[model samples]
Target: MNLAELSQLDGPSSELLYNFGLQPVSNRFLSGNCQNSAPTFSLELRINRDSGLIHLGKAFPVDELKPRYSWLTCFEPEDHLDAMVKTIINLPGVDKDSVFGAYSFKDDSTLQRLDYLGYTKQWRIDPEQDLGISDPCANVETYQAVFTPTVAQQICQNHGAADVIIVRHVVEHANNLSGFLESIRALIKPNGYIVWELPDCERALEVGDCTTVWEEHVFYFTTFTFKLLLESAGFSIVHYESVPYPLENSIVAIVQEGKGQNNPNFSDSRIVQEEIDRAYRFVDTIKFRRHAIRNKLENFRENVGRIALFGAGHLSVAFLSTLGLCDLIDFVVDDNPNKKGTRMPVGNLAIKGSEALYSEKVRLCLLGINPRNQSKVIAKHSLFEEQGGQFASIFPGSEVYLEHIS
Candidate 1:
């Protein structure tokens, strides 16, 4: 029978039949109960339109009576759907409907979902790849490198060459900054240089970006604060550079390998006073922002039933903690498939997929995605509306609530 005629039988007899195109089937084998012996089960194969790479396979089993052999179509094979479809159709004496039910192209849309699971690429660190070595020959014989902390040591070993060892931004994350730096200093060669980079909170505050303060970053470094930190750890700044970037600012310092020295600019009494003053200013700014956020949340509650937060990254954790909105948010959603079904840091809220917003209970979706994907988010919002869901943004100036058309 033709393919269209065979499609009519949806019973067990027609299940195992499959069609094979111009490709060979030796590489693929049936993986169910009929492994060693042929038994009474068989399968068919056919070319699927959706994917040129994969062929559809169906499997069906038969029984032989004592007097005369009759095809006993038990049930559709459940074990190997793909292989069964490919095997049964190519076999002779097998009735098209009895062995192979019907064949259609396999759905390729699921491949996109697979790509979202981070299975598309294989990344490996090549030993020969350059590590941005600007001056490879600059005192190579005398310049021996050392790595501070255990993690940095592992990274150096992975690279296979240790020329320069730098620690910046890491101090803020250390439990004991003094001990951490001291350990690092022990690793440095006698005349080698140690470069440390840290975030300039003063510059970040100037831009009104308080989100820079995070759990991972416990210490905010300014020129004065960093100098004090280095001195405490038996190091003195030999050179310093403030490299300005559009986002959060940074300061790079070249520290010498020697004992700690006292800062001439600040005496013992003045140093204590300056640190106290900086602490008070930071607290005041945090209080003011918290007050502003409370007022905005009160207004937000008046219109929406519940808020669904998007993006479950570090920035979102900081925002939720600072604003004290952990209780206010209904749930958190993220585009990354791996993040789904996982709990968010700090708040411990379960991260869900975009489908969570489809529930009628969620009235507003508070977007916290990175600014780079803002346009893609806007386009997705339009698609969400087509499915009868409303859209809303909660950022300061770009806030908007869009009602969905039924």
Candidate 2:
């Protein structure tokens, strides 16, 4: 059947499964190879209800299952499917012998042809593009390489004299985390250390930040789970700290090579479980707050004449999706030339440049950026304010009105 037919058939069931924490499989075009002569195939992703065990059909194309260039490969690709399955089997609520089925597409089939998967398009950063800040570690050896655990091992091997290899933002969405950790262990000399920096899911849970669970970020690491994971990977944690960053939580883990033994005494599974429990409680408390916020936005939409959303980052997409603000806003405005004219992620809203601010019909601009960029955003649009433009800020759980500058 065509994509429309398949979507219609699967949509309700998919929603039902997803709401229950089970990931229902869907047929999607392979990344980059969508235009290939062979017909695109469907993948059956069976997620265990309790353990998050993800399994796939054996016939799934290797490239499509684990696109080397795609972030999903690093996050939870088929290569890590076995590990996910193992984890799921160890969970409380799983039927070990359940059989799953797979489906295929043929040239003669009535299904509508889909273009190759757009995985590469998601993070295709231009090499020459500047992000307004000089490289902080410009003097440090610039390593032009892929971000993988094996790559981390190689870095340690190449820099033999280095005592510690600090990896910032490298282990966020790792699929084969066990393998990656093993590689890191292999590279470390006796007494050598490895530092991993990642997002703290505990903080995100405390703040009721649903945006933390996006497609790009598949795993949420609580301190306990993180510690357990590290120990399992053969690293003894020297230090662990949680930092406060509004947009993204931070965790710094210092690990050192040990006496070739996995220490079960350091396992913090109970601590991780407690943090998860706290997260669930926090989520429950925010339900009413979220409802109130939605009501307020709906009221504003009914009263406001012309509204435009400013910012096209992930936050904007999450706001639009979570708050159901698509019909309320006219268009999205962004400073990034790359995102301009492209559809916003998840929300699929058409993105426009800052020039959209000049439109006389737009009475208000809703800022969807993080607080750090608030002042710069206001300053950049200062000229527009002189002509009676209004501004507002939309954060995760709150919205505030700003005065129009002369």
Candidate 3:
């Protein structure tokens, strides 16, 4: 994003430019605040040109010890974290007070739920040591500061401060994982656990999905590469599990702060190379896929007229931008009531409630989201199916053009 555009953000601070470093694919826009009021400030996305990766410019981790309205806004990609935490706490001999949460601002609700799940006294670690001055845009006094990233500085600042730090959905945005992990090692209890969660690159390619590739995500991980990287930083993988099947495929990796003889399977060169091959292949075919999706939309327009999108999450933004598919859309439709009247993150479409889709007689609602949950989404929003709405498919084992509701 340019200086002029950066000047307009509701919350622009030195933290953004200091950590994000200014190159981007598009201008900033208001995205979801973890899909709710979240008291957590909403941050924007920026891309690194030299390396194709997504970076969440702002990093202000907040601990929601106090319950507030948490007004519903948009669905955060941080969904399913509640379940993940529940499972983590179930581990035997867990230290309640030592359970610290790091690397997020909007995940307070999920972290707060950990108390009920048997985790007590969770501390929200802010990686931004400096809050820097606010952007001169100066409109809303409440939303004027941008929190920047200083992983090493902040981690050192909190040296030996955490026994168990839970980092969820935050690592992929790191440009320097080794440095970040080293800082984290300094803060962690000598043998404390650092549970990490992120979307899987291998799965993204296997399914022909490229929407996960965005300006905000700089590094993608395979279980093995991540394990090797962590081990190199004097950390040991205690447990690792690849989520079998889900809308956005991901993995849960639990690591300890010391290096040891652990995880023999981390040396699989074959699977490691396979993951690399898949990522390269996805890059190779992205333009073609975008063209193919555009053609599919055009054919749909020829017969059905301008349509809308059913989601407004990060994946949706990435897909629309990557394929130049935003203009082809009339508007966006979402199940989240809080998102109504909001604009699409990367385009001009107004987000409307489910009722609006039917009122407009939307011929099709591009399920511009992860396809794993397509059946469940359609089933819940039966009006779309009963009213003869359709969706376009661009993933593996799926037909081209519009696919009817089955």
Candidate 1 lDDT over residue span 214-327, tens digit each: 433424565655665565445656666565543345666666655544433334546544544544454465566666655655566675456678876655765665556677
Per lDDT, the best of the predicted structures is 3
TM-score for every candidate vs. truth?
0.49, 0.58, 0.66
> Considering summed lDDT, which 10 consecutive residues are worst modelled in model 2?
101-110
1-406 per-residue lDDT for model 3 (tens digits): 3212222222232122112122223223344433422132333433222122223454332222111224523233555666677666765456665556554554566667777766665666443332332323211111112322354345536543566676666666543444455555555666677887777666665556756555545455666555555654556667787775554556788887565543334345566456555545665566567777678777877886668887766567667766677778888777666666666546556778878777888887777656666666677778776777776544455442243322
In model 1, what lDDT does residue 117 have? 41
lDDT of 1 at 167: 46
- How many angstroms is residue 373 displaced in model 1 relative to the true structure, after the best TM-score fit? 5.1
For candidate 1, the TM-score is: 0.49
Arrange candidates, best lDDT first: 3, 2, 1
lDDT of each: 0.43, 0.45, 0.55
Off by over 4 Å in 2: 1-162, 264-270, 285-290, 382-390, 397-406
For model 1, the stretches where C-alpha displacement exceeds 4 angstroms are 1-163, 204-210, 232-236, 245-247, 258-264, 268-278, 345-348, 355-363, 369-406
